[model samples]
Target: MFLLDRPTLGATWGSTSADESRVDGFYLGTYTPDKRQIVLRDSSLVTIPDAWIEHAWSAQLTLLLKDTKRRAEGHYFNIPIPRQPGSESAYFIELADPDEPVMYYTVPAGWQAEFDALPATVTVAVKEKKQGSDSWEDAITIDTIKFSRAF
Candidate 1:
């Protein structure tokens, strides 16, 4: 079983002579076994770090699970961060297997728009860790996906 703490939503604004634009911000904190108290960490990169131009738009904690004896491969799941303003809400998820590895990732979902607006082929960074290995190899170029426009 996995538990998710309340997510946080932040925003950045850009202003010009005629218009103002809002960019969403996402930040995630830690989780606990019980729901009584949620602890916010000071060393969190998303919360303590500051940028002059960019910030987190949305954040969520994802817990991946699989049967160790039956499944040979792992899966990726994207949990959408709630658009709430405070860190009071909590989410819970239960998996069939408890021995599955627990991994934490801080992916900025709000940045998807910038990637979607790119033209044609896009170069992406890939990293992988071999089974039974303790360390992940350095990032390598693997594949590229091309987008088609129907105009």
Candidate 2:
């Protein structure tokens, strides 16, 4: 996540501060699904290192709402298929193919039948919280995200 911040400015947690210039502090992390663990690294991009310990998956949810309104219908199970170990290079090569379709996740043999029978859509509720606010605004209904075979 990118936060508008500078090294000299000081602000409390959940507090808001305004800065004139463009200075962003970002944290990068990777999740190990098989271990159900996330490993975060201190990035050299920013002088002041920041740590994020809350729901790491929230970023994906936030991105899913990026193109749509505050709320949209999403798949109940939108897990991405993980690539096999040592296949990273080949995966990137395949993704470079213009005609190749993108896939969300791979289904194991045991879940293939059940996965195919699953419903196509689900309602996704979204709300916004202003800086330093303890409460979240009421959920709002807006345009739903488009899901196609590529999803």
Note the Cα lDDT for every prediction shown: 0.23, 0.21
Per-residue alpha-carbon lDDT of model 1 for 1-151, expressed as tens digits? 6453443312212211111112222111211111222222222111111111111122232344321111111222222222224532222222213343342332342112121122222222212223223334332222222222211
**Models, CA RMSD each:** 22.8, 22.4
Model 1 error, position 66 (Å):
42
Using all chains and alpha carbons, the TM-scores for the candidates as numbered come to 0.21, 0.19
User: What's the distance in Å from true for residue 21, model 2?
Assistant: 44
Error of 1 at 110 (Å): 11
Q: In candidate 2, what are the lDDT values of residues 1-151, reduced to their tens digit? A: 6664444222111101111001222112211222222221211111111111111111122444332112112211232333335532111111112232332322331000011122333221111222223333332222122222212
CA shift of 45, model 2, Å = 19
Candidate 2 wrongly placed segments (more than 4 Å): 1-76, 79-117, 137-143, 149-151
Cα displacement (Å) at residue 57, model 2: 20
Lowest-scoring 10 consecutive residues by lDDT in candidate 1? 44-53
Candidate 1 similarity to native, TM-score: 0.21
